[model samples]
Target: MLNLEDLGEEGFLERLATWVKTRNPAVRISIGDDALVLRDGTVVTSDSYEEGVHFSRLYFSPEDIGFKAAAATLSDLAAMGAEPICFLLNLFAPPRCEIDFLKRLYSGMEEVCGRLGVEIAGGDSVASDKLILSCTALGKTTDPLLRSGALAGDLLYLSGFPGLSRVGQQALRRGVEGFEDAKRRHLRPQPRIALGIALRGKVSACMDVSDGISTDAGRLAKASKVKLVVEYERLPRHPELLAFAEQYGGHWDSLALNGGEDYELLFTASHDLPDCIADLPIHRIGRIEEGKGAFLEIGGELRPLLPKGWDHFSK
Candidate 1:
């Protein structure tokens, strides 16, 4: 038997996807990108939040866990530029867990679903030794934006500043005070659904920055068969990230490039933005060139970026 840890998350996923693709010809989009799109125009994605792995009761409330879990699946739909229709939840917990705790979790999911105009279509509940929450979001799009559509001469853009969540997680772990914004970001992530909707016809390729730009950019580059050159100084770091670096002696650039869980949309477009794209909150950070692999340019020096983003199996 092959050890899953030896493959890492990406390698394991790629191998699994390759096997599944050979069996199912109807799969429009499979395992490589953020979500899977079917030929019938249905876009589906599922993500899970595990106890101790994704969150801890020490820093997150039941409501926060539920909300973030929903966001994880919804963010995938957003990356595909799909309109969310409904969400289905799979919850597993110890039998002794309080009913109120479960209610609070449902309340959190309801809050996010209400805001996103998505309906809770029902789900299954099972008893387990530990708390596990998983969500499956269903959506639809006429023309799904894919990560393989990028071309040379395309400009790269990010929906918003990165590293805020990383800074927030650090603040929470270190018990650092006065970074409420950062903490809130970590607790409650805002998926860029509206921005994805607006970018439907404009962008050549799109994906969410859940695994940090350093890794996700390479995924995009590999899928599109182009080279991505990101200018280090052009990366927009959150104000809280800068403050965290100043007070904690950490590198903000490192966090912005390598830290995961931002959920911001990363896309590529032509040199000139359409009038529709001009009004959206976006930052030009890089360019796509004719080549392979992703590189970072710092002070006029270019170097290939190592895969330092999140990996479930790699410690």
Candidate 2:
């Protein structure tokens, strides 16, 4: 029998996508991208976190774990420019885990759901050998944004700075001092919900930077059927990441490009961007062109820059 371990996440997704035999008329999107879209303009996404694979009690608090888990799912809705509606939380925990921890975890998710006006519908709970949590979110919109709408000559923009998540993760792992901002960023990433809503009918294509820009950018490019020429120098670097690089010994730009879990939005628009939206701190990082792949321009030299982001199978 075929096993999940044999194909890794992406490989498994690819094979399963090909095996889909039926296509539902109500399903606008399925088996790819950030979420599934219904014909009724509802967007749904789900994500899971395991005890050892995603977090550990040694570094992440129960509350933080709950918060980040919700954020990951919300980020997908944001990518589709969908408005918050409701969500379901599935919990899998060891027999010895604390009840208080579960309470705090639910409270953490409430912190975000309350702010975003999301309702906790309901979910399933079960016993397991380790703590595993999943969040499945539902959203609604009049017109949902897609990743395959970019046309050649559109300008690429980023909602916020990158690299802070990686810096934060490193700081937490090493128990570094005086990097509270970085640590906070890693512990609780804010999804660009407002920005995604603002981008409706304004951008040609949109997606969130979950698995690092280098990797996610390629996915956007391929979906849009165009080549992206990214300007490395123009990529925004957060001040916290700069400080982290100065204090430690690592290349800030390289780290930013390869780091995952940033949860910022990456999008493309025609040159005629609106003044208000363009005026935002949105950084122009690249432009789309007629081609089949993505490339990076560093110091006037153009070269292929494939994704070196996180991959479950890439050991």
Candidate 3:
């Protein structure tokens, strides 16, 4: 009954623009071959990746490397409740790196690009001591969601359960069994693209929990000038994360909150939720308060869980 090509590129956009005309009244230009479109306001974000720092070749295949790189970049756009449309890539590779390495990386990017329906508009490549990949992503949203938009009495939510990535990393490094979810999480973290796009005006504030919950929640609190309370037990910890945490030292909890690659959308809603906010397993894990007392609660007891999320330049 429905097809993408029924309208052509320009006609499809015209139809889409008509569909969202009530929300984004500013999308004056869109689709068509002769002329492009524009909006009064825009949101843009950029991210970078280095060989030894972000990932290791011994663990991540070249294709996975490219997918992760592009996914990480596009994930930021999702946090703003925007649909990723175009992205640019810049790569720096060492002389010793083989050509297959680069092509495979692009192949992985191509796979995700197909899924997102985005194009690698343009970028640059050069020689270096190590691999340095950077991406600048573009998104379309007249009303871009930000962390500062949250308010008191709002409910805090996460798009999916936590600690899967932690489990995945452990499974890969320690050969820990019973970690398929974790392994898949680590190998292919899917940013909640549909959920984010649907959130648009429905969510008060939004962000991707890349660096973990405690850290990212703290950022939301600071930005909104309010307090964030996360219920630890209510935090839908992956079914086996506790066991993995026991076997992996304190790293499991650490990874769950600060591991820096989960790529799930963390958001706040001012009132009741709707069915459109679907895709991942959404959970109402916490709430916002009037003060600056950002902390976490376990069961019924409240405690302070400092925001020590991953920061590349921190001391």
lDDT of each: 0.88, 0.86, 0.75
> Number of clashes in every candidate structure?
0, 0, 4
Residue 156 displacement (Å), model 2? 0.6
Across 1-315, the per-residue lDDT of candidate 1 in tens digits comes to 777788888788778866753457677887777788888889999998899988888889989988888987799999999999999999999999999999999898898989999999998999999999888999999889899999999999887778888888889988878889889888899877887888899899999999888989999999999999999888987788999999999998898998888898899999666424425458889999999999999999999987798889875
Runs off by more than 4 Å, candidate 3 = 1-39, 249-254, 274-276
Clashes of 2: 0
User: For candidate 1, what's the RMSD?
Assistant: 1.8
The candidate 1 region of ten consecutive residues with least summed lDDT is 272-281
Each prediction's TM-score versus the true structure: 0.95, 0.94, 0.83
Q: How would you encode candidate 2's per-residue C-alpha lDDT over 1-315 as one tens digit per residue? A: 866667656667779888886567888888667888898999999998888777767889989998989888899999999998998988888888899989999898998888899998999999998889888999998788888998998999887678888898899999888778777878899877888899998889999998888888888998888998889988888888888888888898877888888898889999755434523468889999998788999999988977888777654
**Per-residue CA lDDT of candidate 3, range 50-92, in tens?**
9877777777899988888888888877877677788899889
User: Which ten-residue region of model 2 has the weakest summed lDDT?
Assistant: 272-281
Measured by lDDT, the strongest candidate is 1
Quote the positional error of residue 113 for candidate 1 in Å: 0.4
